[model samples]
Target: MDRETRYEDSHVSIGSFVLESGEELPHVELAYERVGPSDAPVILVCHALTGNQFTIGEDEPGWWKGLIGKGKYVDTSEFQIVTFNVLGGCNGSTGPCSINPTTGLAYQADFPFISVRDMVHSQKQALEQLGIHHLHAVIGGSLGGMQVLEWGILYPECMDHLVPLAVTPSLSAYGIAYNSISRFAITKDPEWKEGYYNLEKPPAAGLATARMIGMISYRTDDMFQKKFGRKVKGNPGESHTETTYDVESYLHYQGNKLVGRFDANSYLYLLKAMDMHDISRGRDSIAKAAKLIQPNVLAISFKGDLIYPPHELEKMFSLESMAHFYIVDTKFGHDGFLVEFDKWGPLIKQQLKETLKI
Candidate 1:
């Protein structure tokens, strides 16, 4: 495995698994990172798109260190935190990039479509195989947040608490629109080869452009203006003559960063899963979807998030009489819940206190 893509993590074979679409995977493997006490209430930390099972690190810096540290919202002393690379993810998990045992080639375009429910079911199978029948909570943001809601809907009694941050019951039309454009950027690229590209000639430009599009949606316009304005990206003392905008430079940097570590097909598949994430699809209505969530729900909404704005979450969770909701006022947009710790971190701690009595 390329170091840029990923190295192996703690893995558990989940045997044969069937997706919600009736597609069956002959064998499934889930790569995860578990930390904290050996015997303690479990806190399942789901990762966002493009993220892996490196939430709480040993020799490396964990992705959510600011929020999952020693004295952070999810205090490790009181709970064991386990995070897994989503089933359709490339990071040490079975994904479009993984080999299909029957064909002895990467799944690629041949990989069956998966939904958020499929991801939740696979994770549940993996956990149960490891003798974990119950969970303390499911914590995640954005893509991870979608998984959190799916876990609550699919296996309501499997967890005590559900902390879904910056996400709604389903990806809004606006969100899907963004995903559609991103996928188009990848599929149209010549090097993409219709999802059959090898490692040597991956769709670098297309994936990078898709990531650039995603970077814009992740943060707010106000944030970009405040951070970069109309400044030129160049040397400190260099003359600003026909130079790239600072904001453009930042987007390019983010795009390149993802292209280096992520598989383009995995990105497309995950986006499709997100698009198929509607608890109401088979259940009839969002109200019914809310009704299926038996666990204590604590969902956070962001005022600056334009993609899946706070009003959408407010309207959906409103269907559930007992669901707790918090709206944080921040300038960071959809990524705020993932970036700024002070805003939503305390809310998580409070929820943990009420649910776990810690």
Candidate 2:
């Protein structure tokens, strides 16, 4: 919805897409954006949990513009960049907000659970429809990173390089706990009405609280201390009890921002998918799963990230000769991949140039 430069925007019907859980979406619509020449080397950029296909070129600046564009990491002039809203996303894609073709009503809670592999399978279907069989690189961070990890193993021959940034192969206990807290905050809202409530009366309060919890988990103590600390805003001790501290006001702002633009049910589905992500699931062991990855991968971790710490990504060493690990030294925590792009940009450029020759 923001200002973007020249790009192609369209929706593709991918027919019925089946999830790994055996649940099938009778019809799936994927909204996507493409930039650069059709025949150029392809780089598929998977977005984060709440992100959509609008990677760049919006009237409003894109969420990840710092790592993309003319001279950015995935320069559009050199590589055909592709990004798609995932199968269950609400942004121009078939999601809980989309009407069920059969029942003629929004799917809402009726939408089945999806996994990281399912998300990758959906993207693969859309890409195949466009005749894109090979990718110069597959890159993402956070939830998107999980998809990248799945793509490496699921379609080993489809890409030459894999970049999974600030992500864990599976959600850690702490990660799952955080998601659970967020989900509870949303579901407990009486107005949710089991996900069948009217659009105008959405569970804003619950959704905002959920986002507040997520915001807290996304940053480091140092980052928060530097940005907010115990600093009181205005006469908070007298004027407002709720926003007494700068940190409280900041969290409330973030929560409201997300609620204004995102769907609650979609958030639940995506967070559940994250909880279910495990690169080794059904593969017997991590070593066995690592064997399935064909591309040379660069696994990046942020030093102070509590969500997906650097030590967690070291598990990718199971990929052995095919994987190289790097820790991005930053105080920004898990969000460093987004906030400290200046530091990540050069590393990505160097790796992509050397491996994919892009």
Candidate 3:
């Protein structure tokens, strides 16, 4: 298969799997990348929304390269690192864009909705199939952070440490509003054709608009002001200037870049999964859920993260003795946990060393 059609590292069939919604997928293929020696300590790096299995590579720089290098937080020289595309992702995973083995057609709109719990459970099964029964740590940020929490709560005995960054126990109403608007933008595009359009004619305009909306939420107003201010992309003296603000140009560039790689349907599915993340769903309260986590937990909050501000993560303190929390001061907002490695990397290194006794 072409590189674009499947992951270049490794791919495996997960066989039949059922989602939390009772929808069954006849087959699920997971594309993943594993690094270092198999007998070494295992570190599972869960990706954020739109992220794939390529966490660290030589061909192209990865999204978390600064935090995953040789002597970085994960310390690839000492630990085996594993990462994979989410079940409903387009990057070498089964999703709406993948062919339905039963029908010989793309699942498209027929692909059932999935929740964060479903994603965690599916990953657990996949790891078991790969002969990985335990992990030294599970680390993630943003949506990936939610998965970290889910893994701790769902399979407490499977991991020794859990590091969740820039995420809360559940989605806030404000966060939901941002995600809803992004989804609506995609569905409104005429080319969407109710999610049945061919890949060649997919809703590019709508998906681009959706990405622009997501980009706005990912960064803070202070970050925007500091980075762009009133700067104009070109000569504002031109009477017919099509663009005036540098922020506008940045958002457009980010949107176009994502449109070229991501599938609109996968975007909707993953966002919905993020919205459905709730560690305390049936546990009655956040405190009760925290009690079930057996591993050492580190919760990292970003100062300007409007989506999951430090206050939102205060609930994690209920874990009491097992939990440690830290806030990184930055103007990067929710994306700070991804970009401001200088601020949080030391903490990660310290904690990983303390937890694993490295």
| Model 3 steric clash pairs | none
What lDDT tens digits, residue by residue, belong to model 3 across residues 241-330?
486678888988888899899999999999999888888898998878888889888889988788887877776764479889988888
User: Which segments of model 1 are wrong by more than 4 Å?
Assistant: 1-9, 234-243
| Model 2 lDDT tens row, 67-181 | 8887787777777889999888889988899998879999998998888898898899999998898899999999999999999989999999999998987889999999999
TM-score of 2: 0.95
Deviation of model 2 at 112, angstroms: 1.2
Q: How many backbone clashes does candidate 1 have?
A: 0
- Model 2: per-residue Cα lDDT at residue 278: 90
Clashes of each: 0, 10, 0
Candidate lDDT scores, in order, read 0.85, 0.86, 0.85
Angstrom error of the Cα, residue 353, model 1: value is: 1.6
lDDT of 2 at 15: 96
State which candidate has the highest TM-score. Answer: 2
